[model samples]
Target: MEARMPDPVAGPITEKSDHPRTEGDPQEDGDTPRRVVLADPRSYCAGVERAIEIVERLLRDRPGPIYVRKQIVHNSHVVADLESRGAEFVDELDEVPTGSTVVFSAHGVSPAVRAAAEQRRLEVVDATCPLVTKVHAEARRFTARGDTVVLIGHADHEEVEGTLGEAPETTVLVETPQDVARLEVADPEKVSYLTQTTLAVDETREVIEALRARFPALRGPGSEDICYATTNRQDAVAAVAQEADVVLVVGSANSSNSVRLTELAQRLGTPAHLVDSARDIDPDWVVGARTVAVTAGASAPPWLVEEVIDALADLGPAIVSEHSVATEDVLFALPREVREV
Candidate 1:
């Protein structure tokens, strides 16, 4: 079956549950009524909340030309809004004026980037998610104990770079079980592993098993490296994807967690698409799909989810239903600068 395409226009931001319906009551349609199920634990994870708060606070309290090292989060809407509010985003410290205020993206940064920022005397505000910070701490602990640390994550991701910096000489990046098999460690007894917070749970497990099979002494983190948010969102998608004819994941192409959601849905044998808004949706794919499931990534704004729902409602009457695989109430505290004040 062909996949549904996302709408091409940018959609409005709103809470996931606040989707607006068409003019009349949805039940009035004479055709066979199809149901639209929304994933309950779909949007805004705690880490994303903290990151956004950091940017919002910086904008409110600090002066113009505030520089951010990378996209604060993966969503273009969030980045565009920050840019409009006078935040400047750059790939490196040199792009930022010396001694200017700079906030690191939530994806975190390598030690090299941090050193460069310090050399430039940039006033730094670290907006790295606390969960990602946990991975970094794990890398340090393993290295301090004379262990070779295997980091299971996308090698080029900013978060992976930052975590790798904690113990670069001792760290090895593994994206698949194949990578694990070829890994060269100093000693089987002195190896530990950590993961990027936003990795797919099942995929990570396969890699972890591969490492364990190669080295029985391999150590794992006290808790899983994949954060609660990533796990929960994927679980929610998996729960509903089986019942729906099509699945729509609200997220950007570059969003790690969002891409994982789309992958999970497709793995369940349902057609899935990752879109930023309703404009990205291709009506052709949904033409015959009777039931559709909608979800959003952690960094995705709820508004985009609602816009997709609104667009779908315009095509025909939609009986919205809510489905949740798990309940999440996790909340991360704001940075010291924001909380203390």
Candidate 2:
């Protein structure tokens, strides 16, 4: 199913002016007034940016419709924009005609998928984020060394599915600490672990700890598999959540990092909700909440964040300011097929 996206250029919704409140209004609750603190480093990260660009570049240079398998990134606004610009998103290789070009989403694909593309003689552009590609390679390496690759990630996510396919027979998907407890492996002494890049930092840490307790000789990657963008966004939200009464994470439900942002805020004891856009906000959520923190998933665009702020400001004379700092220089290059075309 497709996600709903508002007009990208529209202004905030306003039904009526902010009217004077009655005695039972929030002002009588002895809570703080309305304000918004935006989390910096909140929107489009390097990997997501590169993936979108790959499709945009292809659409500009190629003829007819450029087929992309799955949403290039999880944000509906992004997919909608690309679709308007002549990109068609499909579910699988069979949906794409033989000899037609197909671009893999940032969420990688399996060897079998590659073979299918080869058989179809379809021109392929690999837009799989380098970070995700690293995890898949680690899985293969662990399997080659005769170790059971214990993957810590969501079982149903596209990225996890691709990583598991790399070493399906040897890799066991562990979604929770409980999963680790119930895990069965061929050899206890020979085991390794990798993680989905978009998992909650605290969640993954607990899972890893559980894994280590079970497998004393468990080998981890030289670097953590959780992508830098995911960690940074979660860190920003955690810091902001402490000072806010409510938090709003703007992203599609399928966006893993987006869901993690909301969970992190809730874990910090703040009321948080994941939303597709500012239109999804509930007025009751902000009642008696002095301050609200705003953040977007890495795949989300800045425009959606602004819309939330606009809606909040319309709710009252809300004061808005940024509460975090981010210096991001990381970037991934576009796939070669699009570049050479």
Candidate 3:
């Protein structure tokens, strides 16, 4: 069945449930039908697919080790699969031999990193998501205008780091409303803000509101900084969370978007867990849960979600239904270097 469009006027974000499930045993529950509701927009957004395909094309067409800086898309499974195909994951450009071909991760790199790669004379295949690239451009643009750029995101995230590197002297990182209260700009009248593409939409809105209250003349990106995939997945998961007894998000812990989905569900008053795969699902989390909503982070592969559904079925007779907030038809073109490949 097709998914209905998300409620445009969905209620404001709610606080986490006061009564969270603490302890339980799946086996202890009496005979009950278990239904798994899968979030339709879950798994592999256009940018992630594009990033992985870039590496796959490089491995298939290029010779020697295809060095990739950082986890290609933040999923261990995707990185492992690419590694099995002979892709070398490196922490920095220095790790790659000079003149070797290297691909940057989907998270855009800092100008400093780009300078480092250029210094090493490495053949570069940039896989940074176009959406992230947009933020980087905004950071540079705002700073060039003499506006202090307040980046709303986790301080240590690769995406944030890269954007900060755009204008380190002028860009400051703020993760919450309180951070905005403590922020001191050289000229509050000349302040602008940009956000990490993978941040939670509702929470980011609050942070932006805080910034506005502090700097009434503040400016923002021409468009929303949060990518469409992040917003769609969050909407789908929030809808499913309303009906689900427990919510399971599939993705690595370090995946910001994936973590946001789990956090969104929890905020909507459902017990949620972030799982890398079926193996990570704790039985206690779903022991008494009659309806489990399953969702994968944008970086997670589709097969992993299927595996999780199968594992849940193994626990008992199960019926699965998909709760989609919207259908995603977004596609990004491959980088020019590997486009012909």
lDDT of each: 0.83, 0.85, 0.88
Compose the digit string of candidate 2's lDDT tens values, residues 264-302.
Answer: 999899999999999999988887678788899999998
Q: How far is 77's C-alpha from truth in model 3 (Å)?
A: 0.5
Candidate 1, 1-341: lDDT as tens digits: 11222222222222334443434334333555456788867889877878888888888887777899889999898899889988889888899988898999888887888899999999888889887888888888899999999999997888898998888899999999999878898999999999999999999999999999999999989987788778878877887887899999999888999999999999889999999888999987677778888999999998888888888887776767777656566667777766654
Q: Model 2 TM-score?
A: 0.90
Cα RMSD for candidate 1?
7.1
Worst-scoring 10-residue span by lDDT in model 1: 1-10
Best-matching candidate per lDDT? 3
- The TM-score values for the models, in the order shown, are 0.91, 0.90, 0.92
Clashes per candidate (backbone, < 3 Å): 13, 0, 0
Could you tell me the C-alpha RMSD of candidate 2 in Å? 7.5
Candidate that beats the other on lDDT, 1 or 2, i.e. the better one: 2
Pick by TM-score: 1 or 2, better one: 1
lDDT of 3: 0.88
